[model samples]
Target chain A: MREEKPGPLWLRLYALTVYLFLYTPIVVLVLFSFNDSRRNSSWEGFTTRWYVTLWHNELLMRALLNSLKVACLATFLSTVLGTMAALALSRYPFRGREAVGALAYLPMMVPEIVMGIALLTFFIKVGIQLSIVTVILAHVAFSVGYVTVTVRTRLAGMKGNLEEAAADLGATPWQTFWLVTFPRILPGIMSGALLAFTLSFDDFVITFFTAGIGATTLPLKIYSMLKFGVTPEVNAISTIMLGFTIGLLALWSRLESDPKSLGR
Target chain B: MKRFLAWALVLPFVLYNLTFVIFPLFTVLYQSMFTIDAEYNVSQQASLDNFKAAFSAANLEVMWRSARYALTTTAACLLLGYPLAYFIAVYGGRLRSQLLILVVLPFWTSYLIRTFAWTTLLQKEGVINAVLLKLHLISQPLQMLNTDFSVILGLTYGFLPFATLPIYVSLENQDRSLVEAAADLGATPVQAFWKVVFPLSLPGVISASLITFVPAMGDFVSAEILGSPETQMIGNLIQQQFLALFNWPMGSALSLVLMLLMVTSMALYMGLAGERDA
Candidate 1:
């Protein structure tokens, strides 16, 4: 690992070209966000009109709000349930534990289209009205898988000494958990929540099926716009979304780099 | 008290899974056996009629077409992704994380947005043809949109990152000393790569292919948005049946078959991968 043998220069250049090809479409999307033309053929003059249009569109605003609501709710609920599941699975020696773990992670592997259709069918049969609540519930069902994977790693890596020490010093289980265990794994929990939020926010297929009328999400709205054809407003939204995700990744990297911040 | 609390903590997940995931999946099989009407009433009669309809001559043709498209798209992803992933994993150090983030940022955005971006690039008056015309590369705009080629291109582009990351991880974890030793034993660089690198990274390739294949099999968005009727995949057909025709039974049957195909392929992939590892 310590050896720093430099490879051929052409090897590095070829790698850079590969990266460029992979990312050029997204770069083009971001650049075209500022194009003033209605058609996406040639870039005219730069303008912020599309951004303003996206901001002022009431339907888009509603969809954005719905997406935010579902993502936030799903993140919170999945984080709580997932962390508890992670803790239990990591600590307990129980029957059917592997099966439970497999069941928990199965949602991530199943195709979203199939899950969406299945849940939609289930909701119909069960007489549950499809709404934003249904969307949130569906999101939680999948988000928990991600949260479990993330939080379980942290919990598994965590030694039991701190919580045991707190209990040894006459702390209650609840107090020990809140003070000693929770703080140690908070970064993992937060990171998992952020990932859940982004996943739920960007989800389209499942949300498309489960969402009732008036429960449109940002993705559904963007999908509808695609059906109509490409618009500069779509580019603007993509650019903003791209910027937002990059910013979140940057912030997450910062938080992760601070080793002392995650004491566990 | 501790046992009770543990049970309480586990109950929510258990209940959610049973109600949502397991029940719904089994119900899909159940639903396919019954007759469902427009009024959402289900008849108790069991029959293979829906399966018959789904596997009818025409629909089977659609399934075959979808499979062919999925295979091509998966092949494209591997073709484009392997060399790129190999280059990045071997040569990229400081730039790897940044480049990876760039690859994944589109993933973080809506699938609709990325497909739409492709549309903007592929439409008749779109940037791609415009640039081609401007540069005099062709006398006329390429008739590229709404074809199998467009769907394949979109699916490949969308799934490239999914294929790249696993292979990259596997390659990054490869033992450098093994490669060095092989080279020192008079093996050429290409020989070392084929003997040492390819064999070690086969697991990632298998898993990557599975990940790419399953989703591409069920990916309705890319085909619906980017493809014409001739190129619509099984996903689009399933969606049309359930959403538009309100034919839950046939849709459920179709969905079941698709799921079975995915599971079977994935199982085979993992089986082969494990055998190779052993």
Candidate 2:
């Protein structure tokens, strides 16, 4: 074996710079959330008063709750539908399979603005009133794509004969899926669902277009608050939302510890 | 009967896509193919006038600028991210998963908040300027915010993780024996990297390009939050046409043209990509 030479210090320093580039903005956001001054530029003293202020802000709180509701509903529906889509692609030898898969994946591949405006036109044409329901529909439209991709990858990696083995054991088709297939695929499904929840929760463009009067999600709320100027309270809410996202990610990590699951 | 039953599972989703995806896309196409008149009424006389307007000199300039911005961001991400991905993949050894998790955990945060954070970092009194001043690097705080520089920096920062993960996967999965063989044949490490490692990692690089480029092209959040009107891209234009102008026909037309441009570029890239694999 060739003895490896010690690497140059520049490359290691470059890597350190890359990490700083990725991390510093977020670190700044989090740091300023505790800054006692109304302006976050200079630190006067540290306090969690922004957190207390966040607690009392009715509009931001309501928008956050609305976001959670939309995210939960979108995640649930997309998981079910996307699992079916993944299963239909993986388990069956159907014609036009590639075409259908492409169709399903197009939402994720298309630009967010295109996806947003196109849906806005469709809803307006069909006379569907813009509301939180419409927002959920929009979120589900894209979240389904993420779920299908994740679940489909997991399904592809599985041994295809497990269902048949269950059938050989005298289990009915439905029973086979529930007892054998479901358990095997549950980790993929859960991770895909968690991903769906996060994407839906973080969605801005689609929600902005589809949301009519009185259907503002958290991002829309943030955008408006930002129109005025950046403040410590915005940072506090953002830090809190980031905390929620990390919490979801932790839950997903727990479910995805199985090596068989695609650790995406 | 079995085949039919198999397809039955996909029926609901097919219906859902028809309502949301297919119908919405058709709406954009149809809206783009016609013109709206004085009374806000849709006439059945279809023409490419809206498309012509969409491709007007000014809009085309915006499109070109967006392409340039995306290209710059993609290049920046690749340059910055490739080494980190390499470090994590080759040097990480026992700490690979932990290092990867550290990279990915930041991605779970909201993109808007991250972009907004850049406004704080690049503004005249922001972190970078403040630090630069403290060091006596320059007599003045540089005008970093609301510039092309800030927008691109924000985009590169935002999408760096996307570029890193794919490249790391490619690097990690690369066959070490090929490099070993190259070394055994008396090739230097640099030559081995060029001849073996880079060629093998092209697929990941292409994917990284796709993910980074596509989003950067469509990104308005950074431009809106961190850029002046002079630095606006195609996405910001679409947003303005939709929200500010209330010009649905023009907005739809712009959207169609944007989609066309994206799809054409992607298809072209995929063709080249497929050729690369062969």
Candidate 3:
């Protein structure tokens, strides 16, 4: 029976209603970005004034730049570390290999708050002042886990003979990796990097605890702003952020559709 | 050559992970049980006082509220996600990827941005009320922001994709012939679905629930941004112990409790999913 059971109209209606409910808030944020007034709840005349204000907000721009910096650094480090870890674990068997794999996965499985506080305590105990550097270190810890998992799945499916052939042809292990294995698994690495970059950029809780003074990322900036009140300026910033995220997501999904294309 | 390179490649990765991830976790357990002061001094005696403080009436109330809120959010996501997953799987065709992207996009944005977006939409005289009032559907704006409703809405929206993707992956992989055979045997669409499709998709549903629910339980940002003081969750309490009150012991204890809850539930979820698959 290849036929789908037709759910009741009410069931479909309920689903549609839930979707509307889901999109409604996002739609409101995008719409109100043009509100002239400073307040979020009360709309005056529609204006681009808030967007203009957002454009002029130097502090927010700086925080955004800082976030970009940390995300890039974290992504780069984790991608290299994680891919190498995945390769080492997947390609060769060693004593305690499964145990090592479990350790690699631990960072991701633990709660953010626990990790955050743990990092906080570590930093304080070690007398390392909280800074942007700490945040990057903290992010890389978890980003490495995600990157390893993503890359491991790809490595597991990959045939090993290709690299063996390269080695039999007199290529060193490192040379074989760079010549054959690297190119084949590059897509997984790239996807992992993309995911790590996003996770680091958007991270709130871990960043909150690990980021000491002078390390205000955009999320932290917005969080601090919330303490005072919500404003149209925040809405304008959020709308732009949403657009950027969704646009990236569209591209990611498009790439994700073809499993072979991931190798690209 | 292979063995030498393997150890060379893996050593740094392994060592760093142990020093950072594994070590810190143990440190958290130790910190939770004992007190530390400004000079980084650890007390000689350990006590369960920290756990007691964390589970005190006031803090326990927040923990309970957090569980309630997380459960509600998980329920909402599953309910919304299943149909959407089905629609995309069976009906979406060419637009499937794009629709899936829509579900996942928000997760990339700064969580602050998404939660703030909710506040914008849910506040009194916000766009929702404006539209409703303009339509004359209501004379008064609905009270929305800083309420449980806004918190739940935000949590559900933010986590919906986590719920949908696993379910969609499984649904997409499902063999269509069984459903066809059921229909050929004169089974109604509902019967075919309940008897054929739903059972096969149970694993996806189980995993999706686990993915969304576990994280939602520990989520502090959504509650802080969307909920009022009264609606603050366990996450907020944990934050208080670390940031506000500077109580490391209490923070550690709370973190352990949160970890325990998540582990037990996740294990249960995986167990159930395994049974269903079998």
Candidate 4:
């Protein structure tokens, strides 16, 4: 490896500036979430009143519940389907495999608005009611591709020798899978499930189209609240969400960096 | 039995995608062939009218605006993201992953909240204007929000990570000895970058542009929250048709056109990139 050299000072400054630009808005929002003043125009004394108010807000609480429900169901469905697809594609040679792979990955390429409207039309045509169920279906449709890709990356990195060794040691196929393969791929499955949950939890556009009356998710609620006007409540809720998402990401990165700590 | 198990594992995924993804896309195509009436009734006879209406002068203007805004956003992201990715890739010796995590941390949050944060900053009575007023930069608050600038800024900000990650991947994969070889041959640092480093990183640039431009083209949320009626994009137009006007046929037509545009651009860009490789 070449000797390490610090980059030019200007490059470092430029990078710092870019980081500031990326972070300033979020920082400002978090700070104002604690402002005692109702108006976001000026800073006042700090208070957690908005956060307290958030818990009492029935609509916001319901939206949060709906978001969790949709995210959980969608994550479960997509994780199962995506893991199966990933495992099959990686380990099995089959006809139409490439075609199936392309079709499975197509959702990641399509625009959100197109998918939203198309699903809207499809549901109406099929006479399915637009509700939290529709939202979960839409979420799963888009997120399965992400789960598949994530798990497939982990699979690609893993060695197949362990499974072969288990089989050679007089283990049944199912036993080999449970004893060797499942433990090895568990991190991949967890990370993929985490990704699916995030995608479902954070989705806005597709949910906007599919969610009928009384099925508002957090993003939809946030969008309407923003349109209704700025309030410290939005800020407080956003900060909480930011914390949740970052915590998940930190967990994901830990799992990614030290997969062996999963006690395999 | 092994083949059966493999097919069984794959079948459910394939079937689900067929139901949710392929069928919906076909529905969009089918719906686009007809027209909607004043009472929001779909016409029995399919015609080319919706497609024609989609290409009308006013609609064409929205399409043009979408392309212009998306292109501008892509260019801005490239300009901002390339240098940062370069810095992290080339100079981030020990802290590469940490720096990259910082870059991705913002992206991992909700996009709507991030865009909403801008409203707090760019509103007339907001933080940015307040800062400017205190500094005596202007006599009154500038009309910053609900304009093309705000919309594009939001787009660029939201997609910067998308641009940076790809370019960083491309840059990080480069062979360091090639740069040393270029220097050994009396090439200046600038020459080495332009001839060796930049050329090799074109794949990342191409992918970055593809990912950025395509999503920006279809994005309505940024334009919806940050822009005015005058600054509406194709995405907003589609949203209006579907949600507000109940014009599903027209919305479907517009969506098909948008998809066609994305596919065409992706094909043309890949072809160009391929030629560069050749």
Best by TM-score: 4
DockQ of each: 0.60, 0.64, 0.53, 0.85
Candidate 3 per-residue lDDT over residues A63-113, each given as its tens digit: 888888999999998888888889888998877788878978788778787
Q: List the residue pairs that clash in candidate 1.
A: none
| Residue pairs of candidate 4 with colliding backbone atoms | none
Ranking by DockQ: 4, 2, 1, 3
In terms of lDDT, model 2 sits at 0.87
Tens-digit lDDT track of model 4 for B1-278: 77888899989999999999999999999999999888878799989899999999998898899999999999999998999999999999999999998998888789888988999899999999999999999989999999999999999999998899999999999998999999999999999999999999998999999999999999999999899998999999999999999899999999999999888888987998899799
**Selected candidate, larger lDDT, 2 vs 4:** 4
Across residues A110-139, which tens digit of lDDT does each residue of candidate 4 receive?
999999999999999999999889999999
Q: How accurate locally, in lDDT, is each candidate?
A: 0.82, 0.87, 0.81, 0.92
Pairs of residues at least 3 apart in sequence or in different chains that clash in candidate 2: none
Q: For candidate 1 chain A, which ten residues in a row score worst on lDDT?
A: A253-262
Q: Over 4 Å off in model 1, which ranges?
A: A1-10, A257-259, A262-264, B36-42, B271-278
Better of 1 and 4 by TM-score: 4
The residue-by-residue lDDT of candidate 3 on B171-234, one tens digit each, is 9999877888999999998999999999889888888888888888888888788888988877
The candidate, 1 or 4, that scores higher on DockQ is 4
- What is the lDDT, from 0 to 100, of the residue A65 in candidate 3? 88
